[model samples]
Target: MSSTPKRVLVVEDETEIRELIALHLRREGYLVDDLGTGDLARTQLSKQPYDMVIVDWMLPGLSGLELTRWIRTELKQLQLPILFVTAKTDPEHVAAGLDAGADDYLAKPFDTLVLMARVNALMRRKSWMDSFNVESEQSPHAHILIGELKLDRDAYEVYLRDEKLDLTKSEFKLLEALMMSQGKVLTRKTLIELIQGDGVNVVGRTVDTHVFGLRKKLKDHSELIETIRGVGYRVKLLNG
Candidate 1:
């Protein structure tokens, strides 16, 4: 049986850029769907599920940020990885892109190698998550409970004091790693490896972004996941 190729949607207004991205992704063995506008991309997204999306910051009909927000809020695809590429290289712009729901940001004149690395990392994470979900479904005990927080791996659900908590895929993965380790302090590198797998060149700050998002969703019980100063993070154990 032939394996299914991963599908990627590239939304870039510049024809040259879009074609370049699509060509590289295709060479990497991914099925590429390229669109010139955010509006068209949104329509395509509604038609079917894509493994990942690469969007430009500026689009003709809708901005990349707007499209990302829609994907997160309207489509409710928190697990879907979105990468933003643009000329905006300021720190604030990068932060805005992440806050707008992009999993990764790349400035214009980006290195093709770096772009491929990020794409591979996101795809690997998604693949791992899909496999984990399948395994959890087959396992009898797929749930973990720490304090009042409960994580059901099989259902891909998290509950705080019986109330469901909304979390992004990255946040969920971070929480899962911490909760699984219990009292063990996971270094940022370790956490990144656990979440994104090894060989993925993800910055340490990326982990912090996911942690911030996770903590925000954790709310009052956010303290359950403690940050070890200059070390990493851990889920507070019952005794320690």
Candidate 2:
């Protein structure tokens, strides 16, 4: 993991800004690809995977924030880290950028040194995650066990009482979302965002479809998924 050079995609409409980022990242031993439009960035992402992405906030088409959200929703498991680089440093802009799915941000007219530092920090975190994932193959139940049920992420299978249950991808995401939240009530909005990110234009009821399907798959164990009426859903811990 230490010796692997990371690939970073720079999506900025500003030519100078794009080049500057590529230059610094190249010096850091990263393979950098600079694209000046969101469409091009999307195409590149689909063709080749990137370890991370640096997107400008104001692209001419499909805006950076939108693009980041797209990546988050469509590439759920890969979950590439995204950094927003832009001149919009106002509180509202920052909040929107983060809410749209940016892992970090850099204001315009930023110092090259600071940009480098942020890049290094992000890359280090990525390296640490890679190291952690190396241990993900221990066992299906060990990875996501909850009482007598097992959420097998690798096999994309769920087992209750040693019987395998059929689950669609959306159902798995919904369950994973609830399990990740422990027993906290996940509001419909939060659950949708957690399962689908900001890209999907899903109404609140869309979550109900997935949850309803998931509840059926869990069968008698369905009691674990508690619907909170006007609130949302929670995975009730056993004995709680």
Candidate 3:
């Protein structure tokens, strides 16, 4: 964790639930930001940065999914931890929430323990990634150049043929890991740990979806990332 307390934004339409969530977070000593509508949340998000956000699946002004998409696509805060809370407990609903970019989900009427557990886990994951990036930046060699693809660890950016690439945080990390490993194939579980932090229970399939998105963004250079059937993925070995 940083020297300062992590700030969290809670976006729930219910005043009671919003306050309750904030109360629980404050009890744990986190700074809290609250919003009752998605639009207001969006505006606040643009003006400030929060360490995490807890969003309701249903909200006024915009649904949770829409707000999540806006954060990812517009704000480009792909690394921000999002915990989606909703009454919808169906499998498809859960899948939709994850696909829409939530790092985790909690059903309504949730126990504070479970909610706090997820929140703590996400914070840990964030800390781990931050530390990992710092370590990478400290490395004397901070770049991987493969054909038109280049990932610069110094600037934390990716470029293809000199054009900057807009990749989500996970996608950028995934590509970096793969390109760095080069010929070594990485299992889904291994890739999860490499990107999301060990013991972070992200659904294994989430790696697939992230890879799918990364591949699409890579466009004509997408062929460089090779799927290894049941094993996982690897960057194809380059010829001498």
Candidate 4:
């Protein structure tokens, strides 16, 4: 079977902004679809699958937050990237957007460069999702079993032995990096660079803070993650 060309749906009430994104994305070699309202977006999404959805926070009918919740709750298996582009940059708004299932966001009025970066990030995430095993009723779950610590990829969840560990986004990425290395010590610089992506401003100490939080959250299994004194950290393997 032929692979379908990756398509993105741009849903925004503002005509200029909608066209602007569609134009830029099409120029970047992606098949782009444009819709003016949240209702139209819902209709198109129901009819066909999109690799990613760029949505405006406010709409005449259904709001972006509402749409995100619907997508997350109703379409559990469709892990399409949701990117919010809007003027609302308040911390509460950003948090609400993320909590509502937006994979990433761009605050307006945003630079075209920044928007493109976010778009690329979303597309990269979509590519990752496409490569994931999605044939079965259940998604393939990956477990990096390092001794008592476990990192679950399918659920984006983690645990220590049988006990659950709640980790923030950064903390989880840090743990995943260490667990994947499996006894190999990963430097703080490497961990931050891997998790923060290319352009984000992240310092070495930020990694330390995330590691500290991760260690605290892991509780009794904290020993599973070892600090290498002058180096960084490692997650000890289960069998070795």
lDDT of 1: 0.81
- Which lDDT tens digits does candidate 4 get at residues 17-114? 99999998887777999998888888888888888888999988999888888777776533577889988878889888877777676878988887
Quote the lDDT for 164 in model 2.
85
Top model number, lDDT: 3
Better of 1 and 2 by TM-score: 1
lDDT per residue for candidate 3 within 30-93, as digits (tens), equals 9999999999999999999999999998998788999998887789776688989899879888
Q: In candidate 2, what are the lDDT values of residues 1-240, reduced to their tens digit?
A: 258789999999989889989998998898999999998898888889899899998998889987887786675523466888899989888778876667677888999997886777666655544543564544323457778888765445688988988775557757865775557788887665544422234568999988888888788877889999999999987772
Worst 10 residues of 2 by lDDT: 193-202
Which lDDT values do the candidates have, in the order given? 0.81, 0.75, 0.83, 0.74
Clash totals, every prediction: 0, 0, 0, 1
Point out where model 1 deviates above 4 Å.
137-145, 150-173, 180-190, 194-240
Question: In candidate 3, residue 51 scores what lDDT?
Answer: 94
Candidate 4 residue pairs in clash (backbone atoms < 3 Å) = 147-238
Clashing pairs in 2: none
TM for candidate 4 is 0.76
lDDT of 1 by residue, 76-179 (tens): 78678888889986888877887777887777898999889888877876765565556553343367888788987645679998789988656777887677
